[model samples]
Target: MRKYFHIDLNDRSIETQTLSGEALARAGRHFIAKTLLENDVATVDPLSPDNPLIFSAGPFAGSNFSNGNRLSVGCKSPLTGGIKEANTGGTFGFALGQLELSGLTLYGASDEWVVIRITKEHEITFESAEPYMGLGNFEASRLLHEKYGDKISLALCGPVGEYLGLTSGIAFTDPEQRPVRLAARGGVGAVMGAKKVKAIVVDRHKMPPFTDRKKLMGSIKQYGKLLREQPVIENFGKLGTAMVGDYTNTIGGMPVRNFSSGQIQDPKDGPLQVGGQFIAELNAGRGGETTHACMPGCMIKCSNVYVDEQGEEICSPLEYETIGLMGTNCGLTHPDQIARVNHIANDLGVDSIEVGAMIGVLMEAGVGDFGDEGFIKDVLTEMHKGSEKGRLYAQGTERVGKHFGVKRIPVIKKQALSAYDPRVIEVTGVTMMLTAQGADHTAGNMHSIVCDDKTTEEVTELSMGAQKNSAAADSLGLCVFGRSVTEANSELIVEAINAAYGCELDPSFVLETGLETLKMEHEFNLQAGFVTEDDQLPDFFYNEALAPSHKTARHSAQAVNEVRSAHF
Candidate 1:
């Protein structure tokens, strides 16, 4: 059994709930949504003490259950004004599982900034965060390690988060002890900051107990074997997620210059400099890692360590979203330029997607020229300092666009859209437009869906199914990158869960968890005053056609909502 803690930061009180069997399994996004909905978190001010910040680990957490240690951090999003479940792969979840803890919720705000430490001895201490305050994640992480030693995983609120920046995301320590892995969207960091939690330091220990260790071990080996045999997984392991840019660029679905045009470079002109194939080759030649695991036991290792010409580390896991939004969207052609900014963004613990979109909008407003790396650096520096201009930039893309009176802001539900442009990537666009999580591509990323001739109903149907699947993956702490294997082998997946927890669950439980998660999240958003009209792409997407394909979003909010309403 694992213990879930209700931490009252107000009075330093703690309430523990023991979870076993399916209760331990039914965690992550599903748990967050259900708890929030039940607590009437919808009406609470996102930054208020009433808004609980939840962290959940999956059933197989701390085990060698490839990609099963991803942590879900949730709250009413200060950025989107709706429910948010921002999950990330890191050692945080693994640490929680090691300590035999399923999850914890920070209830109410602390009077001062503090570091909460959880030890293997079952001790919870609230330490002063004074020294770590006003520091970036890198420095804070170092100091935390210095104070608490290296045998701990961290969840840090960066300098931006300390000031309650909407662009901020809670940074988690990776297996390598780098606090770069982030639950990086929808202002979860801002909520953590508002709670005055500078960091959560959990001591790492050996893997926790399981009901059927032999069966679970067999399942683990089987899952790894299945992963090794999959072609898609192999490709990801080789080139990482940047390979997605190659396909998106080829199809004219890649976001370029603040969503002005889709295609970045002609395929006839050799490989696109910004595309995955090019980056993989470039990094490989520079003696940098093209494939690395962000979390322990993740054999599908799609993450990377990007390097400069001198083979110096620039950034770890330079991803497609960061490249598309921060590189192509901002009109910066070189990966080096993107990498420098990525490091700074990661250091500041902000969502590179939101910050990139915000910067792109600023460029669109003529505040700075496109491709001007110096100007981008200046803006980020200000953000780190929490200057007036920096704080304004941190409000995120939507508000920043309004502040500058820019007409073509790329946002849905006040959250910046992911790299996928709705005009060309229709199914992903539908998912982004409708998801309660607010334009998070992970909610249901069907980048391969063909919508060229499909009706709005047909498109929504496809989107709905993908959403359920994605939600299930998130709920289980399984990476969507493993879906090619996991989705096809649902019986095996259920068998593994049953083996670990000694509970009986069918394959259908996967989709059921997803469907239930969506329903709960949607209900929360609805009661939070979000109307059907809130689920839509910006006006520019509907009116302006993306180049090459010259396509515009055709899915109407009304039609999509009609189908969703019927199902939900």
Candidate 2:
């Protein structure tokens, strides 16, 4: 029995509800989809008061399950103009679960900014947060922590969210309590800003009792052993997601120079500056860690902490997407420089991917030379100042591209693509083209898609499978990377679930929940005026041939729609 919390901004009130019976199956993502549809907000403007921001923690949270602390942030996206669910791994999600909370639905809008605090004793407090205005995510978190003390978890935004940047995301602290992890993508933080809520702090002083302590302990140890033995997971523990940069560049999937080329093609150095091993060595020399966990009890710690020349922390856990879009795609060669931009973007509460895409488009337009550190710093300063031009940057790459008259902008539904170049790793491109959430790689992956004889048909099929699995993982609050160990064996997760509530749930129910979530979101998008035509990459992807590989992306609108229709 999980509690449902609904908070009204205008009325400054909080309410709690509970559901059981048939609705129990529809928890987390499923429940969120149902609530959005019931509100009939399919066609409502995402930034309006009527559009609610829903946050849900899945069944695995608060349990001894490994990698089960992902926080799913759900709402009609201002960026995609469709239902959006982006997640982040952190203690907040687990804390919510420990507090026995299933979901939090926020509605209405406030005239002044405020902070919402929830205590372990279930006491709620609202404070005027105007004094903390213009603060960055890190600063805001520190001040909140000072006020509320330890044993509390927080979800907050920075100046980017305060200004309603469409690319901003809600930032949260990791297990060490650093505010670096984020529910990053699809303009989620903009929705938070619209509600005029600066932060939501949850006290984690108490936790619910487990159903079976012995089974939980066994599941935790067994899953930890399984993760440690997997070679991929082991490597992840050594190098984090940035390790994929070198592999993606070799595979012709790295986005370089605004997607003009995959690799930098320098015969002298051979893309070493953007390589993963190079970065791992650089950080190691600086006493920065390449392997760290975003959530507590995560067996596979595929995260990092970057340090500057003084060996002070520059950023924590910079990912391949950040390196690909901001580094190679923008003609940057130094890992330190990329880390600086990542720090700036995160501190300012802007999505690094979105800012990176904007920088790439600007580089393509000759606004600044590629690999110019000063130019990068200047652009970041402008964004922070919110100048007339910086205001354009805040909107997103599509707006900036249209303003600059750049014809080859890589965007879908007004949202920019991630680091993956569509010309290679074809299935991921298909996933971006077809998913209701526009151009999101995390929504699906390219795994299990490539075949001996590659074809557009195979890409579509592989993307569909990955999307379904990913949807399932996100809904269950499980990390998709956990698929490595849990793919062949789901009983571990089932055991954890059974231990949580003493329920005898089937192992397959997790995936089933994810499948239903996808269907609900798909229907919501259709009702929100999305059509088969909207499911597509840019026209340039189909025609433009990428360098080195010299391959062009090819997929039919009919084929993609068929995949979406049949599966979703």
Residue pairs clashing in model 1 are none
Q: What TM-score does each of the candidates earn?
A: 0.99, 0.96
Candidate 2 lDDT trough over 10 residues, lowest sum: 19-28
Each prediction's whole-model lDDT (CA): 0.92, 0.80
Sequence-dependent TM-score of model 1: 0.99
Provide the RMSD of all predictions against the true structure, rounded to 1 decimal: 0.8, 1.9
TM-score of 2: 0.96
- Candidate 1: segments with Cα more than 4 A from true spot: none
Which digits, one per residue and each the tens of the lDDT, describe model 1 over residues 139-201? 999999998899999999999999999999999998889999999999999999999999999
Over 358-457, each residue of candidate 2 has an lDDT whose tens digit, in order, gives 8888888989988887787788777777787777788888888888989878887778898888778778888888877888888787732454376666
Please give the lDDT score for candidate 2. 0.80
Leading candidate by lDDT: 1
